[model samples]
Target: MNGTICQSINQSINQSINQSINQSINQSINQSINQSINQSLSLLQVMEQV
Candidate 1:
């Protein structure tokens, strides 16, 4: 009855929260990886020029 409805709503909220957290974490990891790779490439180009 009312208890079941409340439980359902809570579950939905928790799911959305979990999804948002996962997405942010994934984006952060990807950005760091891209930055590191770009840095290494730039370093290599500089070394070549020298």
Candidate 2:
């Protein structure tokens, strides 16, 4: 029926939106973690040089 088709389409759209949101959140989290880790590592190296 038309209602079932619409429901399925809506479900798929919601699923895709959730997936993309999760992916972006994960990417940003990882990027920030990497940035902080690199900063700390460089700081350690500088401390050792000093």
The C-alpha TM-scores of every prediction are 0.80, 0.85
After superposing candidate 1 on the true structure, give the runs of residues whose Cα lies further than 4 Å from its correct spot.
none
lDDT of each: 1.00, 1.00
lDDT of 1 by residue, 12-44 (tens): 999999999999999999999999999999999
- In model 2, the clashing pairs are none
Tell me how far the alpha carbon of residue 30 in candidate 2 is from the true structure, in angstroms, after superposition.
0.8
Error of 1 at 29 (Å): 1.1
- Summed over model 2, clashes come to 0
